[model samples]
Target: MRAIELKNVSKIYKNGVKALAGVSLTVKQGEFIAVMGQSGSGKSTLLQIAGLLDDCTSGQIIINGNGVSRLNKNVLADIRMKSLGFVFQSFHLDTHLKAYENIMVPMLINAEYKNKSAMKERAIQLAETVGLTNRIEHYPGELSGGEQQRVAIARALANNPDFILADEPTGNLDSKNEIIIFEELKRLSISGKGVLVVSHNDAVKDYADRVLTMKDGILEHTDEK
Candidate 1:
């Protein structure tokens, strides 16, 4: 089964703003897909809908062969915890928490890890994966922007979710850091994890297997490389 599938999805706000217009997509394992668009083009809305952070007005959303468009809050939370990971433009790390603690948040809440030491070990591995082994105990305030964003990415990987959704993940970084951030995302894709990234920078598309453009909440054009 595809990691995630959106079938004719549409989103209409309560104020009558149609953010998505019959958008459909299928993301398979190990595919690095980049979505590019200008501001107000519904890219974030699309990610919100795809990530189940917001509801869709109409359509089917299947993840791992199970439909989740209308699942209850508890069920949705369960699925989110088990099947999805997200990286946002603003690194959402808790300022008071250490990098290792931030990365351990997801696994701590996951029902699969009964032993706390295992969770901590996994968090350390994630920190190592993101090149933060030397700074695992640093707080977000002590870290650079790139380091903070790396922490967010590490937290996103804690669950080992089938897919990772990144919306403007490198928006705060310089050119060098932008490439660093995207290289980590590319590595995840190379390691058999499905990745969907929404970016405004053209350079980001270079790391993707497929590039798609969104306009007025609709996918207008696609290029596969």
Candidate 2:
């Protein structure tokens, strides 16, 4: 099954910046795809489109078999909350919530599980998946950057979304932590979740099953490992 399909997608910002120009791509289920580009190369824009955080100026985005281009804002938000997982360069966990609570936020809002107990159990499972079982009670400020990102990753996975859209997820980490995070991402893909990440680090090329290089608002056909 295809996790995402973008056909001739284009995005032009209000300030008249053309971030993406007629880009087309397909991500199959369980594939690990990486988009490599410098700043302003449209990698982040592509991710936003795939995650339903932003709409394209033209063309279609089919995510998990649903056409997302024409969905109303409310429906789009629902799709975003339920169908996609996002990891960002900065750990966007709530400062006030403990790691477990942060991971549970999405589940609570989406009512992902039938009961409160089930939700809590799933949150704990995700925290353990991200290697944060012991740190689940720690607040974001109390955790290191890597730990915070792990919490964010667990939060993203709380919904068991079929697709993961990550934007420079390891950008804020040290080399050691970057490796750890990338390994977790790899595991996610290996476990049958499609993963698409926007990255500028050459190290990502080593981890990606396919690498797309973007330049001047267009994606270049690139080599893959």
Candidate 3:
């Protein structure tokens, strides 16, 4: 089944800037896809639209068979909380919370997880998977950039989302840390969570099942090596 679908999607900012121009694409379940482009190519816009954080000016987005374009604000929020996970270039972990608490925030926000202890256990399991087992109790301030990013990834997976939208996920890391994050994302793809990433780094090419290039807000399929 297709995890994501876009039909003639376009985005025009309030300032008369066109971010996306008639973009169309489909991502299958568990596929690892990379969107590559230089700055200002609308990759970020596409990522936000795919993740339901933003809307398109014209067109339809069907995610997991649900039409996303017409959802009310509250419904969209619910869908975002349940179906989608996002990782930013800058690890957006809560500064005051420990890694475990940071990962639990999403569950708490959903308000349906009455079993606090179970959620805690889930958080611990995610931390372990992201290789942050020992740093579970550490606050964001205490960890290095890579460790913080791992925490962010763990938090993104807390809800067991169907897919993840990552924007420049490896851009903030050093070479060694970049490799670590790459491996973790690849592992997640193998385990069947579709990953859509926006990156300019050539290092991501080899890891992608398909690579798409964007120019002037238009996307083209690239021949993958």
Candidate 4:
């Protein structure tokens, strides 16, 4: 049971703004957890800390049963690269690169693939997984919002990470695309990936195994739907 846990985590910025206060959570592989909140309620901050993109001001962060709150930057980077995947609302794809090429970007830094051919194969497989096989050669600028977002999701899985942290993944899309993105994320969780999504949309609650609410830096469990 691989899991990421935050034990009594707290974050205080240099300007004395407390973004999180004693927030604790545990997300395990094959589980889908959704966190919903209003803007400025610390949801994004919580995702950043859990994803290892930002440091918490106090408390512990445990990944796969090891406390990693104090690990050095390089080691943290290595762990983040190998163990975690991330998706963002903006669909951070390279405008100049084709869909499959953008998906291959993360594999470039990973030492698991020995050559470009293997990376390309993996990228193609991921493109197929996300239903982008037909658009593999299209650039980001040429794809629809939903298609671009699917490419971003495939790129996130390029490294075959165990956990995914997504922040407002469907913020820029229509209702149809929102459901599409949520369904894709839900499918990923069923495939043994721990998924933690920070979203403002209530529709996510329907797909998540657990739903939590954030209010003024505090986390509260919501009744199961």
TM-score of each: 0.97, 0.96, 0.97, 0.98
What are the RMSD figures for all models against the true structure?
1.1, 1.2, 1.0, 0.9
Residue 149 lDDT (model 2): 89
For model 1, what is the error of residue 112's alpha carbon versus the real structure, in angstroms, after optimal superposition? 1.1
lDDT of 3: 0.89
Q: Over 4 Å off in model 3, which ranges?
A: none
Model 4 CA deviation exceeding 4 Å by range: none
In candidate 2, what are the lDDT values of residues 1-225, reduced to their tens digit? 557999899999999999999998888778899999888889999998878888799989998788987779999988888878999999888999999999988998885467888888898999999998899889999999999989989999988888888999999999999988899999999999899999998888777899988898798776655
Show how many residue pairs clash in every candidate, following the order shown. 0, 0, 0, 0
Q: Where does candidate 1 stray beyond 4 Å?
A: none
lDDT of candidate 1 over 1-225, digit per residue (tens): 858899999999999999899999888889999999899888998898888899999988898898996689999988888778999989999999999999999988888888998898999999999999999999999999999999999999999888899999999989998999999999998998899999998888789998999889899655844
TM-score of 2: 0.96
Residue-level lDDT for 83 in candidate 4: 89
Q: Who wins the TM-score comparison?
A: 4
lDDT of each: 0.90, 0.88, 0.89, 0.93
Name the lDDT of candidate 2. 0.88
Cα lDDT of model 3 by residue, 1-225, tens digit: 658898989999999999999999887767889999989999999999988888899999998898977779999998889878889989999999999999999999987787999999999999999999899999999999899889989999988888888999988899888888878888898999899889998888878889999889898876455
Sort by TM-score, best first: what order?
A: 4, 3, 1, 2
